[model samples]
Target chain A: QNSDASNEPHTVKKSVLATYYHRKFEGRRTSSGAKYRAKKLTAAHRTLPFGTMITVTNPDNGKSVKVKVNDRGPFSRKLAIDLSESAAKEIGIYSKGVAKVKLSYTLE
Target chain B: QNSDASNEPHTVKKSVLATYYHRKFEGRRTSSGAKYRAKKLTAAHRTLPFGTMITVTNPDNGKSVKVKVNDRGPFSRKLAIDLSESAAKEIGIYSKGVAKVKLSYTLE
Candidate 1:
């Protein structure tokens, strides 16, 4: 019911976790296939060195969050990281439930 | 063991949930709180109307997040919102583990 898909021009290739946020609204299951929360700062990735710090910012609200790459994510081509619901709310994206955020890796 | 206690000059009397964030660093337990996930947006509160929206900002990095008041918290006099570990990370406070943040309520 929303038409906020105009700025997806870049279409960069991401891992399975890239599109993880869509699961909350779509009721999709995780790879280990357990229920995921959209409020945490946790994210899924194809393969990132563990302990890597990732900064995610909501383009609309300018809310930024730093996430530590902990475990591996289900390898896919669409998603990058699966954010916890609280993490989304911190960046003001939880209400809309989906946001186009900037994902950058910051070395520790 | 820490010198961050100087800001307690105007300590306000908050409900049970007010001093919640300290639990993680202090290894304190929550009331009836089964091992809670620090990554979720869920928060424990004293008494605010349900569905109220609250804005929490990390004073250090200026990172901010919006949270929905869901359940009532332990009736203590120290903590406010117990942020998930992920939420703290987003605001750049997880490593330090504690932050002084501004809390505001916004009408929906």
Candidate 2:
């Protein structure tokens, strides 16, 4: 049944463990050539293209923040995303260090 | 004896209290029209022009970081500069939340 797939919701959502960037790493250049700022709403993903925008929501508090994927990696196999401190804070994970987050991305 | 004012180290340096931006402000629009990122090496000052690069040094530890002025702030009478979390972290202020910093600006 060749139904139109384009008509379906294009937003991709997933659940993953989200952690923040180390504060010590701030000012260091990122893989994207932009210096890492723990205060920016940006994140590092294993494979997402740079500039990819994602909405990360903390399942515990329902708070969400939009971030641009500008770098790569959580490095650990268990964590799916590494967020900047600001991004983590927006989703209520700044103090806890890590949290389970729902990631949503829409196709442009 | 006006020998050479231009050659006599045109870098202006000052000691001021530097604080980090509130994490809640991440993703908000900065005065420069760019989103405020606590993770970027950016800062807010009461009068510095946007994009003015300044070097911030921690007097207690001697650690330093370079940041660009991108917003206007530090409304507090005691604080002279407002740094992003990453900027603060770079100069060893992230953990303490505030610090006595040496600010140096070089003129072109």
DockQ of each: 0.06, 0.04
lDDT of the candidates, in the order given: 0.37, 0.52
Alpha-carbon deviation at B8 in model 1, angstroms: 35
Winning candidate number (lDDT): 2
Provide a comma-separated list of chain B TM-scores, one per candidate: 0.35, 0.61
Q: To one decimal, what is the Cα RMSD in angstroms of model 2 from the true structure? A: 21.0
lDDT of model 1 at position B24: 41
What pairs collide in candidate 2?
A37-B39, A37-B40, A38-B38, A38-B39, A39-B37, A39-B38, A39-B39, A40-B37, A40-B38, A40-B39
Off by over 4 Å in 1: A1-108, B1-18, B21-37, B77-108
RMSD of 1: 20.5
Interface RMSD of each: 21.1, 21.7
Q: What is the TM-score of each candidate against the true structure?
A: 0.22, 0.34
Q: Candidate 1, residues B1-108: lDDT per residue as tens digits?
A: 123456442212211112222224222222222334556554443333334455444333456555544434432223222333445445544454334443322111
Candidate 1, CAPRI quality class derived from DockQ: incorrect
What would the per-residue lDDT of candidate 1 be over residues A17-97, giving only the tens digit for each residue? 122233232333332234345465554432333444555543334455655444333222232222334555465545553
- The alpha-carbon deviation from the true structure for residue B10 of candidate 1, after best TM-score superposition, in angstroms, is 25
